[model samples]
Structure formats: C-alpha cells, structure tokens
Target: RDLHNRGGERFIYNLRAEPATPEFELHGKYYYAQLAPGTRMIWFVNLSRQNGFTGPVELKVEGLPEGVTATPVTIPSGLTRAAVILSAKTGAKIDARLVRLYGKAVYSDATGKPRDLVRYAHVTCELQVSGGSQARRPINTQIVGVTNPLDIVEFEATPSKITLRPGEKVEIKVRVKRNKEFTGPIQLAMPFLYGNSIIADQLPPGVTMSSDSKARLTGKTVEGTIVLEAATGDSAPKPLERFPIAVMGRISMSFSISTNYASNPIHLTILGADSKAAR
Candidate 1:
C-alpha cells in the first residue's frame, strides 16, 4: 500500500479519480529504460483479490509522446492479470526525461456502461538507482530491443515471514522469476551472518547449518523452499536475528551469472516457546 514515485515525479491530470470501491484494484510498474527507435517493451498489469469488477475492464497508457504507444489491453472477467506492451517506433519522439509512464483502470457497472478509476501505479522496469543515476533491469518477461536493459533475478516467497522458538524449524517456499533460462541445477540459500560481520568461518549461506540449508530448482521450475532452524536444546537468550537470502538459478545461457533473487532483510525472533508467526 506504500505508493510513491521513485527517482522521478508522477503527473496528475484534471480527471476525477473514482471513489475507492471494493470491486478490484490495479497495479503497474514505475521505472523503465529509455526507448530507442523501432523497439518495444512489455510490462504487466495485475488485478487480484477481486470481490467485484466482473466483466471486461479496459486498460490505458497515459503520458507518452505521439510516436510512442501502449497497446491497451482489456482484462476479461474471471481473469486476474495480463501483460501490456509499450513500443516506440523507429521515428517516435524520444526523450529520456520528458517521456514518462503510468497506468489507469476503467470498468463498467451493472448497467453495462464505461467509467473511470483513479490513476494507479504501472510497472515499468526492475530498477536500481545509485548516486542519483539510474539503471533498468528486465524482469518477468523478456526484452528484445537495443535499449540494452539487463534482466532481473528476483524471487517472491510464499509465507514471507517465519517465526519459531529455539528447537523449531519451518519451511519457506521460494519462487523465482527471470532466472537465466537454462536447464541446469539451481542453488537456493540464506544468509547466516551474525551481526554486521559474516560468520566467515563458514562461508556461503545455509552451508554452516543442517540439511535445510540448500535446494535445487528442477527443470523449468520456478519454485523452491527455505528451511530454517533454531538449534535445539539451547535456551540461552539471544537478540532477534535477521538474514539476507537469494537463489542462484543455474542455466546454460552464460558463464558465472548471478541470476540471484533476494528479499527484504528477513529476521527471526524467539517470542516465546509457543508463539505463532503470521505473513
């Protein structure tokens, strides 16, 4: 629910935003690379947790130049999400700073008419901004243009949070996207560092611990799991602990490419002998 324009400003038109309703929600990316001549980019629009908004909903791209266009897509009822492609023709007006992007969702009510909703965040690129400069990385879908954007290696965890006391173990399901498209084995891991310094005596995540440390991503599969354990029979009181985690999806396309996906710093806390965890 935290929505803010990153590295740039979002534009607001005089259009009236629809009142917040319980029907459906729309989400898009914010950052994208500068478009070159004669090329296009693909991004996603996701609508989920639907209690209403049935029937077809039209998607539109706002704030682009004359030559650049977003292929408007309509999400049919009962479907959750779909992709929209944005392209700049070989002669499209191009400006790295002037051209910006966002998305809007519109749906009709029971009377079979069309209406408008507020402008919502539209997905652009998997981006990283350092020192006021920016870089765009490809994610989810493949990019096939001279824009030269890099691919993103990220993962989303099923049950993102886990809390267990000493002597307990839990399994966290990991699903990765944009891993190098190869047929080899993948290694998923977690950081076992204590405090700011790594436990250098044992390098590489999960290797210092029990069998729950590592896993393999099978053929064309995007799923894996993380098994965490608090050593048994050791009731010594310790501060809450956190770790950084990522998965290396092994593929045949290149050399030592770190197609690694990570998460926000995940922590473990022993609230008591029997407290439960929530996502």
Candidate 2:
C-alpha cells in the first residue's frame, strides 16, 4: 500500500522501497585478537566510505577457535563503525585459526519497505595466554580499535550559517570543548573545501588553523577562526545555496597516544546569485 497526502508545494509520498540501492563499504581483510582465557576483548570493523547509506547495520564473527565466542554487534543508523566483543572461556583452547566476519546492512526503502544488504570479511583469530605477545601476522593492519583517545574530545563552530555572494567574504570561528576534570590538548581540522552543501576551509581563504594536514592538540581546549571568500565574477561555483560544515582533528594525551576525531557536521545556508532557500 502507498500513501500520498496532498499538501501545498511540498506533499508527502510514502515510498515502499528505495529508488536505488544504498551502499556502505567495509575495509580490512583480516583482524588480530588475543586475550587470556575467561577474559574479553573489543575490536572494530572500519568503513572506508559510506555512500549515502543512512541506516542500521549488524555484524557478527564466526569460525573462532574452540572455547572462544563472539558477541554480535549492531551499528545504529547514521554511524560508520561496529565494535565486536570476543570472550574466551576459562579453559578455552590456546590455538590460532582463520575466522570469517559478516555484516548485514538493514534499512527501509523509499516505499517504507524493509531491506538488507550483506558483506563478508576474513579474520585470523588467535587465543593465547593473557598478556602474552604473538607474532604479527601479514594481514594485521588498519590501526582503528576501541581504545582511541581522540574519540572523547568535543567540537563546535560559531555563526554556523552565513550568506554570501560573488566576491563576498566572511569569518567563521571554531572551538574545541574538552571533558570536565581533565585538561590536555585538542586541535581542529577539515579539508579546505566548499561544496557538497558544506564549507570548511575554503571560500574566503586566510585560514588560521595552523596545520591543516595534521591538527595536533596543543592544549586541553582550543579556539580559532578562518577567513572564507566566495568565488567572484564568472567563476563562481554556486549562485545561492545552503551548505553544512564539519571539522576533523586529532587528540593525544602523550607522545605515544593519538586518534582521529571529528565534529558533528552543521548546516550553512547561503543566499546569493540564484539560491532557492527563500522559497
């Protein structure tokens, strides 16, 4: 059944399925995990890119060594990572084996129809004595896991929305909020780009965020602003549109610890040459 409610210029149409297939890519061919018997460990399956797939996903591990079991993981809608918990019995076998990983993307289609997409990965599972080191395997790459320090920092930008025309310029301020009772270092980062309905370090130029290649944390909290200039004359890429904003950076407590972190993207509405925002 379908529902089409007649409304002003913006009517509602309940789609039963998606117009096209949504895509989400999972990277990493193998994973390395080791833990003591009766103990548990956490790992992750990283995503190389998410192609407009805004839905929930489920992940599971299979073929682990005897006495070791994996608790399935489910990624909520709009998130790009999944964490799996591996637990070993007190008397579990101490051995090494190849295991299989699985992922299923679940979501609703445009027509409100339920749908699912699936993917598979391979992992080299190892069970060993607690605190013991095992020889690194060939496929043990991709340094993303559960214990990243950069994951805890917070970020925000001021004057989130701005209006600009050809040859116009503006200044936007960004701030990094840190956790209470703790002070270390935080940095801000984002590609120098303007498009895709989001503007970061482009437009007015004169960006003052120090290192755009790698935003290193300098203090427990940080704040800065950048100049953005709109294209002028005949080379303007956009006439009038609203774009969102996002910033990325790294956080580290010590020289040996660091991870990547990004701010929650926000929208920026632009009113210029031929924007349809007013309608």
Candidate 3:
C-alpha cells in the first residue's frame, strides 16, 4: 500500500498518495524579519535553473504597526535581488514577520503558494537634544580635538562678535604681561589696522605713550595710552572687516636693575552716524 491506514475492523482499506509534481515544487526560501526603528532589510531568491520563472514576484510583510510603511519589492533584470527601507518613528520598536508568495509556474503545475521565512535584527539609539535644557546643563565629558591644555603662545586680539553698523567704531584693549624681567630702550609698535582702517591715523588722532621713569628699567611702575583718531568722511565708513595691531619695545632701562613689565592695547570705537549727524 502506498499509504498506510489504521483500523480496528476485520478488513480495512488504505488510500494512495503521490509526491508533488516538479511544476508545483518550491525552489528555496529566505526571510528578513524583525528590525529596529530606522532600520532596513533585503531579500533575494535564486532561480537560475528554472527557465519559466521569468516574471515579477509579489512580496508582502504583515504585523507592522501604524505609521510604518514597507518599500516596493522588485526583481532586477538579470539578477534576483530586492531591497526595502523600514523607518520607524521616534521611541518606536519594530517586531514583525515577512511572507513571500510565489506566482504560478509558466510550464506545468500552475500551483502557486506562499512560503514562510523568518529573520530578525535589532537597533538601539540615544536621543540628542540641541539648545535645550539637557544641552544647557553641564555634564562630565572629555574634549576630543584638543592636544595641549596649557601652552604659551603670542598675544593676539580681534573684534568681538557684536554687530557694528556703518560708521560705527569699536574699541578693543589687549593687555600683555612680560614673563621675564629686562630693561632697555624698547619701541612699542601697534598695527595700523583695527576693525576699520585708521583713516590715515585719525581714528585715534592723539596717540601718546606715558610711563614712570622709576618703573622704566628699575622694576618700579609705568602707565600710558596710545590714542588714534578716525578720519571724517562724506559718510560713515563701512563695517570694519579686519583689525590687526601689535605693541612692542622698551622706552628706557636703568643700570643694574631688572624689571617685569606688561603692555595693554586699547581700542576706542566711534559711532560715525551719531557724530556725523551731530556735525
């Protein structure tokens, strides 16, 4: 008997069955199942030997929550590969199954049924808040891009980020303190440009230097200011693009005396609109 049967009667009969035909046979199966939020999945099938399987196949997945959509699945011209992107909303978890249904065979059986395949992947993400309370709060964290924390470099200064209208001048003061003690004839040089041009040295028309003779080289003390004047133009000067300046030199030094000294760069800004309108 091709089929087996069980019975308690004296005489019993069994039914016969045959194996599935080649035309109705399924080739192979694969699946891309559970995925995390903002994740992707891919699927493919191999059909190199089958000559009649030359058409598109329908792909579908179920159990996905609301607000989630699946991408269209298509088989390439010469290759049997398909891809899809599965994006999930924030604070969402994805867990689902995929089902692939094969179309009717071109040659014989005309029997097409769906095959089940299971696959899974997971993802975890941390939220980042920008310019919010969490960002404003201080936390213990190490800096990544800096090498030297403490390195002595030359002194430099630039205009602050504050906005300056046309004809407006800003004053910036840079102070430099000497690390070692020395005494000699020093010359103080300041860059001619600060924010806006000096207008032929008119911004601070009155540039002067003052210091106490005792503090010159004897390590006593000295104080002074370098003043510049801005030129009066038909209209206020355009917004300052770049301002550069440097101060160097020793005015005087005493005999057998070493002193530590420092210099300050002072900048004064004039509002040409106010001054010009006033004039």
Candidate 4:
C-alpha cells in the first residue's frame, strides 16, 4: 500500500487487501531520512500472522538502486525518509552526487506478504564555495583664454630708439592697467637688440629684472613698472647714441597665472633703439 497527501489532511492509498481471520490485520509504520554523500536504506517485515494460507507474493519497487544496505527504521512526530548515496574521498577534490528521500512505512496481512508503505516529501538546503583576482585603468586634459591688468595700459621705454657705444645704459618701464583683478604671478621676457645689428644679449647695468623670476601681478594692476639698465662697451665711450630699445622682445615669458592654471606665454619685443642724447 502506498499513501500520499496531495492537498487535504488525509492519506490516499493505491492497494487495499482483506484478510480472512480476525487475527490477520494490516499494520503501517512511517520513517524519515536525509540525502547527502553516503549509502543507506530501510526494510519492512510482517510478524502479525504466523500460520497457513500463503501464495507467492512478489514485491518490486522501482526508482531504487540494487546495491543498497537496508535497515529497519522509525520516525518521530513529523518527518520523512529516503535512500542516501555518497562518493569516496579524494584529497583536495570535491565530491558531487544526487539522492532521493521520502517517507516509508510497512503494510502486511495474513494471506499477502509485507509491502512498502511509501509517502513523498521534500528537502531544503543551500550550497557554497570559495577563491579568485581583479585590474586598474587611465585619465585626459584641455586649455582656454588669457587676461592682464587694467592699469598696465601700455609698455614704454625711454628714447624709444637707442644707439649704444658698447657699455652705455638705457632704462624702460612697462605701463600696466590700474585696479586689475590679478592675484597670481606674471613672467616677462625682455629681449633687447641694437637695431638688428647685434643682440644686446645681456641685461643693462644697475637695473635689475624682477627677482621673483615670475613676478606676481597682484592687487591693483596700477602701472606696474619694470626698470632695466643698459650698459655700452667699455671702449666705445660715445657709442653713437641713436639706436632703439624694445621691451618684451620676440622671446617668450611663461608662468602660472592662477592657483589652478598656467598662463600661455606673452611675447614682447624691443622694436628699435636710441641713445641718451637722442632721447
């Protein structure tokens, strides 16, 4: 006899038998089991009837392997049982297998042999495992516009043109915008030449460029001035004083204009030269 519960609180069966004697009654037992990685089974026997009236009764159960070990079992209040199969242990390697678990009971009568009382049930669990690696990846940049002081109106040099004997000296001032909004440093590159004849190459005597290397056009940009002294050669006393002196000659001046950015170079040139007498 096989019993099952599909929906309600009742046991449904497939086989029913009637015994002739009052001593020949049917008995049923329930069992529960778990499936993992080992081998196990269960068996049932009928001890209620002792004598007579017996024909050859064949019991065949499908869905079960042939090589299984059977043991008589019992279940508590609410539980089920099934056949469990397991794999042999191999060092560091994982073992994997499947098993079917269900509830089993025994049914027996005087005329018929003992049969399996089976019920279907379910099992719930979780699986887990562990180890593995991870990589790094790069970034890009761009540019914009330029601004100077308002007070620094224009750049002017004395004797707009200068002619040097050899060691003669000249002075120039770069006029700046007033009340400007510059807080960062400014770098000026002054290039001086003797009217395309010979490049002054060196700075003038007494007059020094901004010590800041990079001058700061801070506060109000009011007529910021840069004074430069030009010295002529020692031999040429008069030095023909009538050449040109240019400020910010073709050379480039570069520095950081802000706390966060760098300023593109502002190129200035001394176009002509002149001497003290010419001025």
Return the number of clashes found in candidate 1. 8
User: Which predicted model would earn the best lDDT?
Assistant: 2
Give the residue spans of candidate 2 off by over 4 A: 1-20, 28-30, 109-112, 122-279
Q: Point out where model 4 deviates above 4 Å.
A: 1-159, 162-165, 178-180, 192-216, 230-245, 249-278
lDDT of 4 at 241: 18
Error of 4 at 60 (Å): 99
Q: Kindly give the stretch of ten consecutive residues in candidate 3 with the minimal lDDT sum.
A: 143-152
Q: Give the TM-score comparing model 3 with the true structure, all chains together.
A: 0.24
Q: For model 3, what is the C-alpha lDDT against the true structure?
A: 0.29
| TM-scores of the candidates in the order shown | 0.36, 0.36, 0.24, 0.24
Local accuracy of candidate 1 as per-residue lDDT tens digits, 80-194: 5544545566565545433333334566656767776644443345343655333543233222222332232444565644565656677777665543654455555543222
Alpha-carbon runs more than 4 Å astray in model 3? 1-32, 47-51, 76-78, 91-279
Q: How many clashing pairs per prediction, in order?
A: 8, 16, 21, 50
Query: How do the residues 1-279 of candidate 2 rate in per-residue lDDT, one tens digit apiece?
Result: 222223564555655964456666654423555544554444545543355677656676756778777664555553454445565656766666666666787766778798788876433333333355333223423222222222344455557566665555555566665556446655444542212222223222221233223344554546765445556455553432333344544444434333434443334444556555542
lDDT of 4 by residue, 1-279 (tens): 222223454654456776543222112221222111121112221222223422222222323322322222223111111112111111212222233333444545555677654433322221222221111111111011122222222333333443332333433444433224433333333422223332222222222344333333444432234444333334223221111122341212222111111111122222223434433
